[model samples]
Target: MFEDIIGKMRGDFDIKPMEVMNLQPLVLAYIGDAVYETYIRTMLVVNKKTNVNTLHKMSVNYVKAKAQSDIVRRIMDKLNPDEQDVVRRGRNAKSVTVPKHAEITDYRYSTGFEALIGYLYLINQTDRLLEILRLSVEA
Candidate 1:
């Protein structure tokens, strides 16, 4: 399934096995940021049919650090040991910059949430990813 997507969208990015295995928390968050934003944008376009400004506002509500942290708090109990570990890893990662508007705790938790998404994506656990994302979005 993913292979087809990769083949069709053969862009400049390439994921080497070693990199995936030894990925840093920051790197995971980086990838997760893009993935989560893409999901938000796609969902809004498909379901809301709103203008760009409205879509951006809605997307901001869902994608902000505080929002992501709330989603993680709601869904943490549903995650398994490995997923929890990924979240913890991301939460503990050290970042140089801080979010201008969000609290530090919220930012950390949001990073953790992103790390979980990135980890699941690297493992090609699409069903699990979708399930978690659906639950989070609905919450």
Candidate 2:
């Protein structure tokens, strides 16, 4: 389970939520990936009353790098400067993993999107996170 994964990620540090900014962008993206995946799965099941297999298929459209890249581009101008900086850092950060089907630009933007989500989740900024998520849907 993700709890076990998270426990491993903790390593030897006692990281507080507010201190997430000090972490590597890739690390933020790691946790953000989990957060985003759970968000999409939960939303789909709640709104559509779908079965697991159907929900899994539907969620792929929204969770893939290409879709996240598009969503990030659409919502970028809405972000404040601080948030934009976080995205910029994430976009520029080098990651070892790359999606075979996505363009480089799309993958970078998706990383940026995940980084933003990660930062907010780390800080417990649920309202702001949800607002951005809703805006992404409108896009």
What's each prediction's TM-score?
A: 0.87, 0.85
- Minimal lDDT window, size 10, model 1: 2-11
Candidate 1 segments exceeding 4 Å error: 1-21
For model 2, residues 1-139, the per-residue Cα lDDT tens digits are 4334433444445558657888898888888888788777767877888688899999999889999999999999999997898899899999888779999999999999999988877766666877776776663
Clashes in model 2: which pairs? Answer: none
State, as a TM-score between 0 and 1, how close model 1 is to the true structure.
0.87
Instruction: Please provide, for model 1 over 67-117, each residue's C-alpha lDDT reduced to its tens digit, 9 standing for 90 to 100.
Output: 999999899999999889889999999999989999999999999999988
What overall lDDT goes with each candidate model? Answer: 0.82, 0.81
Considering every candidate listed, which one attains the maximal lDDT? 1
Against the true structure, whose TM-score is highest?
1
Q: What is residue 35's positional error in candidate 2, in angstroms?
A: 1.0
Stretches of candidate 2 off by over 4 Å are 1-18
